[model samples]
Target: MQSNPGSPHSDLTLAARPGAARQARRHVARVLPGWGMAGLADTAELLASELVTNAVRATAALVAAAPGEDRPPVVPPDRLGTIRLRLSRPGGRLRIEVWDADGRPPVPRAADADAEGGRGLLLVAALSAGWGWHPARDGGKVVWCEPAGP
Candidate 1:
């Protein structure tokens, strides 16, 4: 993890796996108060989880679909995916950016009351002032969102 001095910002790189979301929540919880942004912690953590979860899912899917010998080697040579989480409170808005190794952009599903999943982006939209994603020039994409009302 890397943090900027004199700023409420940090960059966390984690293995894109099943438990990454939980780790992200812990990091957010640890940083928010010191940044003087505790009020946004709950919602920020939720959004961070959703984004990281989606990223891990996408990376796992990609690895599973790749050819046996074409799969990218993970840090441990078996994990096969990576995610970078950037947390920043810039201009009075808490921005959560999750970068995954997959380039597919997330689409918000319809408001379905019966769906158990596929509602991550929907939750992000509802809880955030704005949300969107863009493909990274190097690879993959970055999904970002910010809390509502400062």
Candidate 2:
């Protein structure tokens, strides 16, 4: 979560939890007030949901692997441990960035037409204007997408 020293639209971090998704939507709403973009809130909420859900699941796996004092829900405290949500309005797009504590990038699984699971990233691809991932210096990866223009 490195930020440009003087950039106002630099970086923001939010806890990774089920409820954090809703909080993220609220944050986006507050930040982009009067944007009047239809379905923007829903898109943001859905993206937040998918990303946070994945992060929580990954954290649980890490906790199970390392038995000791109850590890915090997020992992790799100084590195890949915390989930990071970065919202930026640099150009004509609303960028939603979700960072998780895993260096291995996420692969969007192809779901069968009749399948009930493995559709989160598919939804992300369908809704977002564009989406992709990048490796964080600290061994985690940031998956991000841009919403349709306002």
Candidate 3:
């Protein structure tokens, strides 16, 4: 994580592992309040965790498809690169973004009630003030959401 105490922006890049989401949640939980956006901490942490989890899953999917990539270590220590979580206040509104190597846009699904997952983006859409995604220059896509008003 790279951030200054009163800075308006902070960035964290973590290995694409199962624990990455939890790390992201902790990052958001701290950065938001440090930036005087404590009101957004809960929502930001939740949304950041969701996006990071999705990114990790996408990375793991590719890893699981490779010949010997199905190793014990979840991320294999940088084999699949990292997931970046960014927090910024654009126009005074808190914006959270997660970047991964997946270029395909996120698709919201109507999850079965009995499903154990698949509600990440749904929760994001319901909780965020506005959200979207754009292709990143580094070859992936950055999914972003605004949790606070302008």
Candidate 4:
């Protein structure tokens, strides 16, 4: 886990596991008391769930691509790989960033009338003021979205 030098706020890192996502939700809840941002607690949990789910799925695909003998270590239930979720209150807005080791950028598809698997990012875009993805220097990618109006 890399750290940003001279940054005051600490970043949260979790393995792409289901339990980790839950734990992250709980942690965010606990921290919300200090943030004092109305309705932010629920928003944090929802966003975390969506982002973690995507990370886990991507990690699973990567593991499956590797040779049987080179597969990754045992991942926790509902978790697939390493993911970093960072929350920062640098100024007026809350920045939510979810990073995974897969370098592929997510392609947001237009959901079919009856489709069930393509709505996560759509929800994110709706709730967030703005969102985008970029490749990380270490071979993975970071997808970030900011809440509207701080």
Q: Rate the local accuracy (lDDT) of all candidates.
A: 0.83, 0.65, 0.81, 0.69
Q: Which of 2 and 4 is ahead in TM-score?
A: 4
Candidate 1 wrongly placed segments (more than 4 Å): 68-80
> TM-scores of the models, in the given order?
0.85, 0.71, 0.86, 0.76
Q: Where does candidate 2 stray beyond 4 Å?
A: 1-12, 34-39, 66-75, 78-81, 112-117
Per-residue lDDT for 116 in model 3? 95
lDDT winner between candidates 1 and 4? 1
Evaluate model 1: give its TM-score. Answer: 0.85
Q: How would you encode candidate 2's per-residue C-alpha lDDT over 27-71 as one tens digit per residue?
A: 665554444434476777678667666665555465456667544
Colliding pairs, model 1:
none
Overall local distance difference test of candidate 4? 0.69
Which lDDT tens digits does candidate 1 get at residues 1-150? 865445678989999888999999999888888787888888999999999999998887777774774543333334346899999877867899998876777877785688788989989999999999998766778899997854
Q: Give the candidate order by descending lDDT.
A: 1, 3, 4, 2
Which of the predicted structures, 2 or 4, would earn the higher lDDT when compared with the native?
Answer: 4
Ranking by TM-score: 3, 1, 4, 2
Q: Assess candidate 2 and give its TM-score to the true structure.
A: 0.71
Q: Which residue pairs collide, candidate 2?
A: 75-81, 76-81
Residue 81 error, candidate 1, Å: 1.0
Worst 10-residue lDDT window for candidate 4 reads 1-10
